[model samples]
Target: MQNYTKFGKNININNIEIAVKTRLGQPHETMRNGVMKERKKPGLKKARKASQFSKR
Candidate 1:
């Protein structure tokens, strides 16, 4: 907590750290949705063998 003083007001440093990571999680979750959509596209392999034989 003491080390966080450099970022947050020295007296409230620990408080700021608490919300730092929580605020970033929202964008991460949205990126997952996009990633899942792309993975579902036919371009990606569903299995190792499926991908190898796909060209055939």
Candidate 2:
């Protein structure tokens, strides 16, 4: 299992689970920006890297 951050919370979109990081009132550009910001977080990046290495 992967650890989910606040920005990468799973949401149901059209019956599919998608990871979104923006607020409901935010614009589309905000969603992109939010994902970019989330990607820059060291903790999240580290967690992702760790998960990848564990899969080997």
Candidate 3:
């Protein structure tokens, strides 16, 4: 089951919780090269792809 916190800053899936943490104040694409972009979690990435495929 997926649930959101009161403020909706993070997400809880099954028993694993993942927070939507962003880099700096702006998106990484907008920055030149301050720091490497935040890599997406493998499990979350896979789940996202699966959800997209299911939507189609």
Rank by lDDT, descending? 2, 3, 1
For all candidates, what are the clash counts?
0, 0, 0
The candidate that achieves the highest lDDT relative to the unseen native structure: 2
Error of 3 at 40 (Å): 1.2
* Greater-TM-score candidate between 2 and 3: 3
* Order of models, best TM-score first: 3, 2, 1
Compared with the true structure, what per-residue lDDT tens digits does model 2 show for residues 1-56? 33323444453343122233224322232244334323355788899999999998
The residue pairs that clash in candidate 1, if any, are none
Q: TM-score for all predictions?
A: 0.21, 0.32, 0.36
Ten consecutive residues with minimal summed lDDT in candidate 1?
25-34
lDDT of 3 by residue, 1-56 (tens): 23323323332333122222221223222222433355466899999999999999
Give the poorly placed runs of model 2, Cα more than 4 Å off. 1-39
Q: Write one digit per residue (lDDT tens) for candidate 1, span 1-56.
A: 33433433332333443433343322121223223112243445457568678878
Which lDDT value does model 3 have at 35? 33
What is the TM-score (0 to 1) of candidate 1? 0.21
| Residue 50 lDDT, candidate 3, scale 0-100 | 98
